[model samples]
Target: DIKPIEQLNINNLINKRNFRGIFGTQPPLSILEEIDYIIVSPGVPFDIPIILKAIEENIEVISEIELSYRLSNGKIIAITGTNGKTTTTSMVGEIFKESRKDSYAVGNIGLPMISKIDYSTNETSFIVEVSSFQLEGIKEFHPHISAVLNITPDHLNRHKTMENYIDQKSRVFLNQTPNDITILNKDNPITFSFKDKTPGKVILFSRLSTLEKGVFIEDNQIIIRNEEKERLLVCPVSDIKILGGHNLENALAAVAISYYAGIPIQSIRKALKKFKGVAHRIERVDIISGVEFINDSKGTNPESSIKAIEAMEKPIILIAGGMDKGSDLSEFVLSFKNKVRYLILLGETANIIENLARGQGINNIKKVASMEEAVLFSFNIANKGDVVLLSPGCASWDMYSSYEERGNIFKSLVKDLRR
Candidate 1:
């Protein structure tokens, strides 16, 4: 131990493990002699002093995901995007479960990939939901199958530019060979541009149109065609229980990924029909006074929130705004033109979104300081059949530690309304 502490827990744990523990923000350079490679978590920025020092010292600095990838031995399917990554990853995991594969759904939405490495085997399947931050430090980390669901303007505050952000997301398929397969969103121009980027067999999924070879919706049914132009129908659009066209894309992605992995068509259909959805992304909470409450806290970006706004069938009493990530929310505001009845905003970007909404000639906006207030105001103004949606078009860092935390709090508040 290098620093004195009042608590014995951390010190005792360090002593019990018989390892050195440095408790300060900055460590002395003398300690560097024993340190070989520096492991960075996805949350840790590379520009920090210690990480920069490690880089300068020619030490191998890598993200925990990269380390996990190096140690993980399984048929890995890595999914990354600005949105729908969680849903898509979870869907793929469900498909694997139906097929009875010894699989683990780990990464951003579940356990850390590193934690599951010890449990992973040659026969195991790891459905990893990777983020741009996790992709930052990957060296030889490659997945057997990789999918970039869609690329949108997100995390610009960290990457500084759209190009750099895409660059990191692109890393998911960087080390794949021709033997591997990569699923790209054919409808997404940015992800579609990756058609020429990978050596892996490009499997495209589309909701708008049919593709020559890949997964697509045809005659309102999910279909896949191989290189030989042979078509296979998985299931009908009505079979999927998840809401939204965006979720339909996610379902198509899951099919593309699992079908390529050799899952039976029946198993794929079974999973698709049975798969509900992940929490915090357009999740139905409870209804009070005939008003529907939806938690779409996973809509951490404007593009994502736009989809959530579009997904609703009822007149929306939209609750949005969170930590500003310097995104163009004009489209976000514009999407609420005829759909959203009233807006209750909160968090850092509340004023910014409010001004944008007003500039667009919409004045039915209420600004609140907390989620409880946002929910109450929405409920107060909401009538029978109006949807109160908490689809924040920004990150949760302004108020909560994570989107899950923000969504949980909103759910708690909504459920409390019944009390």
Candidate 2:
């Protein structure tokens, strides 16, 4: 049975070509007779009653990316991680565009792979940014080049365990052969462990130490050494405009993915210089009364927010808390030491985070009802040279539709602070 969730636009759902008016709130306990195959979206948990019923009955269960991969003939450069997927995917997309290749960036970078399949040819290239949710249901979704940026605790509410989440993220390289490439981050322990497991050739990227054959920073220049031991200098680290140590990792992953995909060095260099970053990720919104405001509303988990907190140079008046995703916030609360001056909490997880902070001996916290109150509370407490960061460390589903909507609302409120 089809379940087009009620929260979405009904008009848009009905307008789909050849869409039959067949939707239900819940599936029958037994789907064996009528349903032979079920294509589940990433948003829906695989353990849901209907999908579990399909599995129990031996019905084929797959994801949209798996279906698109079966139908499309294009080369796929798929990247997945707890964070940095969007930035790396878009950076690789821009690098391909510089090469004048017939390529599209899809799969969670705002577009679905199936939608772009109709126009793709054998020569087409698809740079896909996949989430663990999207990767969880895959059976045969393979990419020509796959990169796992870093693994962290996210979507624990759905996956139920970090082990399962890591396995799902690793599935991006599940179908690869010896000819394909798997790029991994050396600094991230879980990601680096995959180097030995992958059948395909492995490429490593690091910010800490030099690699025998991978990408590394040498004398402040971004350099890559392939399996053939050929060294190529792409650009200086200064050429990268994106802030934070995490984004540097993203740039390294993008370079490895794009360069291995046969994109020219000149094109990669030019693209690296031109691409700033995707929105809602540590994006600087504005400054009011010498206090800066940043839109990191995309920081929907503790690890992501931790990175945002580390990226800031000035004292922070942080606005955090939203729909709890079952993440451990002890590290998030502990990191506030000497960094976060005031904590403005909102949404469903407000009390949870507040309690965690208080337990950590952090008492400079305020709980608010809405984004407006959070923004105003932060502004009132922020001083000159201090930054007001909106890194929620929780999903926006409790208060807003999406992270983008949350970020836009934060931006709108911050803009109004001037008035």
Q: After superposition, how far is residue 162 of candidate 1 from its true place, in Å?
A: 0.5
Tens-place lDDT per residue, model 1, 245-303, is 99999999999999999899999999999988989988999989899999999999999
Could you tell me which residue pairs clash in candidate 2? none
Candidate 2 error regions (>4 Å): 1-6, 15-18, 21-24, 29-32
lDDT of 2 by residue, 1-419 (tens): 35464656686757776654456567666545866698888888887787888888888888888899999987888999989999999999999999899999999888999999999999999898999888877888889899999998989899899999888888989999999999999999999999988888999999999989989889999999987998899999999998898998999999998888898999999999999888899999999899999999999999999999999999999999999889888888888999998999998889989998998888998999999998988888888999999999999989897999999999999999878
Each candidate's lDDT (Cα)?
A: 0.90, 0.90
Show the lowest summed lDDT stretch of 10 residues, model 2: 1-10
